[model samples]
Target chain A: MTLLQRLAGSARREPRGTLRVVDPNPLNWLYITYNTVEEPVRVTRRGKVRPAAMSSYRWRGSRTMEIRVRPGGRFADGTSLDACSVHRSFTEQTRWHSPHPPGTHFNIDPRTRAEVVDERTVRLHLPEPDGLVLGKLRATHVMSERFWRDLGFGYARDETGEGHW
Target chain B: MIDAPGPWASGPFTLVEGRSIISTEPVVTDGEDRTWLQTEDRSPTVRLRANPHYWDRVRGPRVREVEFRNDVDRRRALDLVCDTVGEVDIVTEVPHREAERVRRSRHARLVAVDSVRALAGAIDRGVDGLPLDDVRARRALNLAVDRSALVRDLFGGHARPLAGLTPPTPLTALHRAPGRLRPYPYDPSRAARLWQAAGGGSRPLRLAAMTDWEAVAHAVAAQWHTVLGLAVEVRILRSDEEQREARRRQAAKEPRDWDVLLLEQGSQSADVPPLELHRAFVGRSGEFRAGPVDPKFERLFDHLRSRRSQLWQVLAANRLDRYVTDQALALFLVAPRVLYAVNERVDFQPYATTFELADTSVRRGHWSLR
Candidate 1:
């Protein structure tokens, strides 16, 4: 609701629902919606969302920062957020993780992701909820940690050009 | 629907009397009163006044010269109507706010008939069948599309938008929530899992789409990278070639041939199994790719083959919505609407669905110049 409240929200967790969950503010709402390997493939989320769920760090709620990364290359479920995962999101998707560098016009807060509780469960957390905030998230980007590492920290000078950022 | 327009040289008065386009001034003498028609013109504007030398159907009076001036600027023209420039009538291209303004004006009456058209999630071309075997991946793709923006921008808050392919037509049966509607509007992490579950991973998806809609295709490709972590290859082809390729993939009935196609075809035009089947299932030779199906889509397909009633078709369309959205054939974007504004006196019927050619025939004779 206010600047102070928004900053305070990042220190909290998120909630889930059955059938469907219309997220009020999905941008910073750190959460996950996964399916159980079990039959019916019912949607599941983190047992308890944590504000600092798995983020390596955080910004002052509004300013963008740079998260320097290197390549781990290989990616699979258990693949650590290495050079490869981070690189792809950067080079391929033209994004970064954790604190995205300056001029990052669009990106999912790289500092965002869920820690796997098991083969099925993944927890979530968020910064805050606002109509304008989440509404703008409709046009943001989400890249894996591996993508950033591979890309290092290159930024797109001109998005119109078809080149690696 | 048809484009037979002119100052209608054959109607009344002659264009020879006017000097410029969008701005025409004509002198009219009805024995009781005289008025001059002067205004800027553009956007399908032409005026029709009393025909003096001609003879035609009469509302009350018989013969006089009709002035047809193009008041392409809706506001100024509408203002003239509000001010009543001596029976200066017929204004098409009336703004949304002025839709009521003209109605309230003493100079003219409004003939409104919800002519707004919604152009939501339309596939540029229709495919014959499900391109992928994975229903989850299909749902993921549908969810990745931005339907709310379309609802907000296209309809101007005048209509309800659905996130299903078949939308909420009377014929629709299956319905699903717009999972992941906003915030992270296009979820690639979830999409990756769905793709993997649907027999993918390792390599990126080659999302197929026409080149004309480059932005939409790019958005899909970017989302694929995040969700499925796949390198999506967007391809563009001519409309006819695109149709040929898409139908071939749909008809091939093989998942290996095509992964996904971000289409833009008219979604809510018609509802019937025969119509859909002819296009998606039992399509023309070499026009489909999603190969054979279970007894379900087949049975449903068969039921749609018959000519159903309008009410039946509406219900069927709603049912088809579930099939397409769930089956991943189409994700309802927005129930898009077309936008246009005309002068105040232009009481011609507005047709958002069909071509807006009759916007030309808004003459004083047919137009009630109140």
Candidate 2:
């Protein structure tokens, strides 16, 4: 092989692990990964929310949301992910941890309540119906409940400082 | 609670951060055993390998790794591609001035496509004591801008003048009425008439613009000055972050800081999610950035976002564009062409949304070393 070809060959390994991405624009500090495709959501390319983690979702009169978590979905740490986790994720993200400044961006109403309906189902009780409810749910990054509880209010930490979920 | 620490990731590649990441050796992911290496030179050369576990074997890990070198100094990157690099697969965001030179280079092939990027100046009607609050004053400013000259002179034929916020792609072009295809042409006499009618000459106008496009902003200001004797003040923002901060301040209960703010906005799609556009213009749910909502604009935005059918959404978008333009809520600038250089050998697939790298993937096994 030619030198360039050999250099390429040497870099290759089984289950090849290299995809370098870059952007000249500096990331927003508030939402560091906002607008970046780093976070994958349960949404199809057609802008419809799908059941990657949730088996199904439906709106009740445009105000209440019922989402069914898919069974057998596990977190990176091998814990089973369920409806309570999803509820916690949405409640925390939209209320306390949103990057938007108060009154500036569209925020989920504070009156909204995410309650665990069952082991695999969660129900969101909204004060009023919102058309962009699906879109709002898609933007939420569901975190592992165990890890979230352990870490408290800060980010998940790794020994090497190189890991984030 | 909502964010993550840097050292952990779920994607195929683990980031090794530095002034630039240099991946001279391969590393495997946690548990997946997917081997990949991402390295960068200090000047910013990014080399990436595809995961053998997930990548389409028939299409690519095409050869091995894809190397990208980014430099704000385009000339240096151009030199690397033209003179020193051996079959470097791709180069992106090339300025139009360098297109001809790069086209002549034997080492790479240049491809130019229409970009989704559009430019517009959002007039802050909420700012107190500003003539921009009057539609006639806003119209005078919009009429004064010679968009054709700005595109030709500032962008060096790299852009097309925009009539609306959405780039005139197949998806978004229909949202604008046929007559609205071109923004109001340079009409000094008409602009003067509007300025006079709006009582425009008494006070100076303050304009907030992005630093990169400050020259264009200045030129527009100069046109208004000459045509209508309007004294315009310009404040330049260094980046989008600054503009967002300004918008946030504007959205507050306090009075807005400036009369006109020039900003760039890009959409994920043309209009699939009309709610985003709705929230942006009318300050629906308190997301108002245009500074002071016009009652008509607010009504149209609500009507547009409320529609469940895509057909109605498209129709509403058309009406919205015409109304916004006529009201002079925003002055549409040029939509730049996305350009890139690629090695003739690589079977590269370029997506229109260059900002999202995951969307642009090469076909597997389509590349061979000569």
Candidate 1 per-residue C-alpha lDDT over B237-272 given as tens digits, one digit per residue, 9 for 90 to 100: 556556554544443433333455544332112223
Top DockQ prediction, candidate number: 2
Best by lDDT: 2
**For residues B195-250, what per-residue lDDT tens digits would candidate 2 score against the true structure?**
88887655688887877678778988887788888888988887656765665564
Q: Write the per-residue lDDT of candidate 2 for residues A1-165, one digit (tens) a residue.
A: 456754565433333222222233331111122212122233322223344457677766657778887665554344556776677666666544232222112345667888898898888888865544554554455555554565423333322112121
Please give the distance, in angstroms, between residue B231's alpha carbon in candidate 1 and its true position after superposition: 2.0
TM-score of chain B of 1: 0.49
Residue ranges of candidate 1 with Cα displaced over 4 Å: A1-165, B1-131, B149-162, B167-192, B238-258, B267-290, B293-295, B305-313, B341-345, B356-370
What lDDT does each candidate get?
Answer: 0.33, 0.54
lDDT, model 2, position B65: 44
Which RMSD values do the candidates have, in order?
30.7, 9.7
What lDDT, from 0 to 1, does candidate 2 have?
A: 0.54
The CAPRI classification for model 2 reads as incorrect
